[model samples]
Target: MDKERIIHRICALHETCPGNIVTEKEAISPELIGLNIFGEPLVGFASATDELFEAFKNSDIVGPWFLSPTEWLPEAKTVISLFFPYTEAVKSANRKATTHPAAEWLHGRIEGQAYLLKLIESLKKWFDDNDIKTCVPITDQRFEVVVAGNNFKQYSCVTADTFSSNWSERHVAYIAGLGTFGLSKGLITEKGMAGRFISIIVSKELAADPRPYTGIYDHCNRCGACVKRCPAQAISLAEGKDHNLCGAWLSKMGNLFKPRYGCGLCQTGVPCESAIPRKRRT
Candidate 1:
């Protein structure tokens, strides 16, 4: 398909997608970005790695093509960094003044996990109908998928999606325009950072990454409000991310808190997201 039609179809899929702008292939600048779905191949739940990989196949996680779980497919020409913002879910659930308990973290966020699942399913169908292959955009979910297994550590697979040099494949989606680089661990879009944000890596399809996002980093005010508010004190002023504290805290809490979710202090800035409007009010 022509790039114009492919881009047009994707934009039409999302009312807020801002439509397509510059083509990615015509000019692959040094600043050019791409999604790296090649995480730990057999990393997810049990020996079901192949089965788990198949789930994303023929899915419209982004109107797509080949999915490279451990490496980018050489055949993939176009990469679509699909983004789904969680600001609304965060605002709606996070109505308290004091911070939530560690166990109750990420509470106010992810109210729309089910909605997102449906959205991905819908998009997958659309891509399948259009004959486009899609890849799996893994996040924390992949970690648990493996951890749930009886003997996860014994396997050759990793606990999560950790790539060479890049560590946990953090920059891939961000550079791909899925969202902006955030100091609080992951990327933050207009939707505000609340919970797991999936990156839909589109391939083979002719389309363009909507611009500005292509060469931008979310200008964190550096207020460090998240650092100050974090109950675990997991955030460090010198280092950008403190994986140890974050992972340990979440593990100990273990479904004892209010909403029974992951720690949210990092992204639950009381002031940062104020700029984002409260409700859609349909």
Candidate 2:
């Protein structure tokens, strides 16, 4: 299918999907029952043979555990990456809370992810119906993510790292021309950093979107707003993001929120929350 067709389908799905709204059963409060979880999604495509995919095999990037598009789908011709930005309701709610995640934000994190998965599956089925093969690595049985210790060697080239995942949506999004990494390690797109990312590798040939920039952090303005907004103090201008500290904080939040846990303080009320922060006035 053409890029316009794919984009149109995705937009339509986002507009009508029941999963995109926080249902009463899934919401933490009655106020959040009908809250919209996500805004329109931004989609980008990359050639399966993009050199950046190979570069991701390096230890510094994603390690050997990082699977390229071809590795996920042998005949993969294009990698489709999507960034679904949180709705304004979610972002505003989170902005009001300084430490804990707001109910709307919590639903956005948990239910929003569920919606993304459903969307991916729908897209995959569409490709299947068209006799085109598709693979979503995150949903594949082979997908693996090591959150603690240095046992990632079995899954990656990383021998000493404490955290590693076989497939990273953010990294793939970058290669697909979606966005760049922010100071908090979030992918900052034109729509901003407060969002979730998902990707699929397909056999259908689609022209790759040209990357508008080269550097990995080109979109980040280094505003340090995220640093000050971090409740865990996990971000700093000098050191960037501290995943260990952030993970610990999330674990503590898990204890409090149970099945639904998240802290997106760094993502809200920040210069990069809703858009690429404009260059500081001289």
Candidate 3:
């Protein structure tokens, strides 16, 4: 199918997917029963052969552990990146939160991610039905995430360094022309840095979208709103985000919230929360 057709299917599925809605049993509060996890998504396509994929293998980038599209699917021709922005209900709840993650934000992280995976599975079925081969690296057996201080397990994909992964959705999204990095290290898209990303490799040859800017941090604006919002003090204007510090705070959150833990403070209550921030006037 063409890009338009694929986008249409995804958008349509998003609108009707029962998983996108917070059910009474899953909501943190009565008010959250009908909460929608995400708004309409923005999709972008990149050629499987994009040079950026190779660049991502560098030590300074995602590292040698990074897997290229072809590695995930030998016949891959395109990489489809999807960004799902959090609905206003989700973002607004977290905006006023301080030390702890808001209940709404927690649901968005845990349940919202479940909904995203469901969406991907639906798309995979669509591609298979069309006689197109596709691979969702995140759900694949080879997918592995290495977090420092966590009990580690070896995987066949790659011995990724701590705080890294064999396939990074955010990096993949960047290559797909969906957005660029912010000072907080979150990918800032046209829809803003407050969102979740997922990607897949396919055998369909789709024209890659043009990256609107050159620099990796072009859309950031360096406003540093995220720095102040961080309850963990994990971000800084001079050094950006410290994953270790961020991880420690998330760990603490995990203890408190158990089944659900998240902190989107850097994502909301900022200029880039819902849209790319304009450069500050000189």
Residue 57, candidate 1: Cα error in Å is 23
- Residues 1-282, candidate 1: write the lDDT tens digits: 664564455445543321111124321232312211111110001111223233332222110122344343333444444444333433434434345542122322223343344444555566668776654454323332222111112111122332122112233444344445454555554545554434343444443444244333344555566777666776655654455566666666545443345556556654444232233234
Estimate TM-scores for all models. 0.55, 0.94, 0.94
Worst 10 residues of 3 by lDDT: 151-160
lDDT of 2 by residue, 1-282 (tens): 699999998898777766998787887878777888888899999999999888877665567777888998999999999999998999998999888999888888888999999989988888899899999999999999865444332222223435777788988888888888888888889999998999999898999998888888888888889999999998889877777788889999999999989999998999889898877656
Model 3 residue 155 CA deviation in Å: 24
Model 3 global lDDT (CA atoms, 0 to 1) = 0.86
Which candidate would rank higher by lDDT, 2 or 3? Answer: 3
| Alpha-carbon runs more than 4 Å astray in model 1 | 1-74, 87-89, 92-97, 101-111, 139-170, 210-218, 274-282
User: Which residue pairs collide, candidate 1?
Assistant: 38-69, 38-70, 45-145, 60-124, 64-133, 65-133, 87-191, 105-262
Model 1 worst lDDT window (10 residues): 37-46
Native RMSD of candidate 2 (Å): 3.1
Give the TM-score comparing model 1 with the true structure, all chains together: 0.55
The Cα RMSD in angstroms, rounded to one decimal, for candidate 3 relative to the true structure is: 4.2
